[model samples]
Target: MDLESHRFISYFLPDQRPELCHSATIEKFPPGTVIFEENEKPDALYLVLDGKIEFSKRGGLGQYQNVAWAEENDFFGEFGVLDGQPRSARAVTCTSATIAKIPRDRLMDILERSPGKVVLQLFHHIIHYLRLTTEQYVNQMVHKHKMMAVGEMANTIIHDLKSPFTGISLANSMLKDLHQDEETQEWCNLIQAQITQMVVMTEEILEFTRGKATLNQKTFNLGESLEKFQRLNFIYWNQHNINFILRCDNIILNGDENKLMRVWQNLVGNAVEALDEQGGQIVLIAAKLGQDALIKISDSGPGIPEAIQSRLFDPFVTYGKRGGTGLGTAIALSIVEAHGGDITFESQAGKGTTFYIRLPLC
Candidate 1:
């Protein structure tokens, strides 16, 4: 056994059974070799003995971004081992590397019989991981709050100035029309439309700050809600050449009708925008699952990238699209969760995306 390999084990499995340490085998990989891909089943934990490893994911636009890097003495793959879940990121060798592959079953066995050392080590790793994660989360939250605060402040200013802005826009339109200049009229009309959009967005920001603009819960037919939502938003969908389909029936639920309306509105609006004039199909389905109601909205647009899925519900993490505030889905999720419900989504590149909402039946 290499001294470096032993040192790696000592860092994690110190005071463990010697036999368990001997059970781990040193594996080597060359640069560009994929150690594992995201979502692969849990197998063995890899402790890097030497060289470097890169953790990356495919971006929403079909590009790869390196999110993390691991070097000698560092470990990767513990998350999958501990959670019994698939890998969340792709790991590839950045150079010639030697790694100790610690079998998951053996690790579990040791953890069950001699939990103290294992638990201690696991706890230490978790604490360190969580510390870093929490720091990043706190920083992101602070940044988001700052952005929201600025947005709110700007919204307030806009609200205060809206009357004058509207008056000026109307005056410009009248002047352009009276001058009989098509170019000037078009420019004025565009400016007025943009100002109008800004006004609407400012109102939404104010509403989001108050947290009082969500749906008011009531017992209503889910099918009816879908129909009404579709009818109300059909023109927007049609203008964009998008197809809307409803596959739900007479499923009823106790939820805020207006809030659910917003939910559908936001989701559908997102899907349409994601399609970006290429046009696609949007499907809404509702069904009852025992004591819960299940609603799914699927889109034939480019699916959300795996990189952003974990933080997709977080506020203001946009993909840099036009008119995207990145708060719609976040607000939608908060509303659903408040109603004793949960929301989840699935997406894949080039295929499509689907959002699932599960709520307890009233």
Candidate 2:
């Protein structure tokens, strides 16, 4: 392989200086092999000569989330090598791969010996890395500002609506005693129901905007919790013709029942939207796995779309849905994580999706 042809290696030298190339060694790894892991010290920078490598970060539970992929001619571990910091993410071989392992110390010594072009190229690489890092930081800041702006606007609207909602509710209560007519009584009841729903929506919005969830932890039977949850959402589920097949081991868990219920509600609600009015089966299965509790929510609906799959849990990321504030999964994630649990999922585009929640067993 010619070192000068690739952007990363080329930036360290103008051409394949036999002396510089001689300092590096070639190594090969088979598929499924971990080349480096998160928090490990960077000993060398790697240049992918063939096949592919996957970069990932540890996610909730024992799973890893894909960050990016490295194809032939790509390089990684440079940032850690330059800064003398631990690896920011893990690298694993996606296929049988050939990699050029350039020891940072040897490469630095070679560059120092070459007084002209080598030093200039090294300077250019550092500047480019800095520029890219700055751009990413600015983008994140912009996104954060946008979220804050939207949240503040929503909070104001919900606050203003509360006063009128209170007045309407009071009038409905007063009119209830004045009239006993069946049709009139029905109308009053409908209005009260709508007002109650509005209040719940407002509260949910406030909770999401605060971006904090405190678990009301306690020991409770998982089966009993599911029963109460079923009763609470029976009306909506029945109206949509959605079937829930609950299989529980009746395991006792120590966590906030209400918050965990919220997690289930969010997952099932999203599944319902995917299923539409056609109706589908949602299976809730809970079991004990060693010292942890494993719960899976599977739905026979069209699975999540590909475009937003990588960022599915990110705040404000939503698919094609009407009147969606896009905070449901984000809130669910916050609540589960607060209870020292992790959430992950598996989905096929046209098939279905299964969400897994893992929490420590008490």
> lDDT: which candidate is best?
2
- Sliding window of 10 residues with minimal summed lDDT for model 2: 11-20
| Decoy 1 TM-score against native | 0.51
lDDT tens string, model 2, 1-362? 55545555565544546655677788889999999999999899888888899887787797886656778887788778878899988999999998888898976666556668666766676677567656665666676676787678768878899899989999998998899899878778767865764565555556666766655689999888887667666678988889988888969988877667777878888888888888889999999998888999999988888889899888888763555767778878887788788999999977789999998887
Q: What's the lDDT for residue 123 in model 2?
A: 64
TM-score of every candidate: 0.51, 0.59
How well is each residue in 253-361 modelled by candidate 1, as lDDT tens digits? 8977766666777787888998988898999888888899898999998888888889998877654258876888877887788788999999988888899999888
Candidate 1 residues lying further than 4 Å off, grouped into runs, are: 1-141, 150-215
What RMSD value applies to candidate 1?
15.7
In model 2, pairs of residues that clash are none
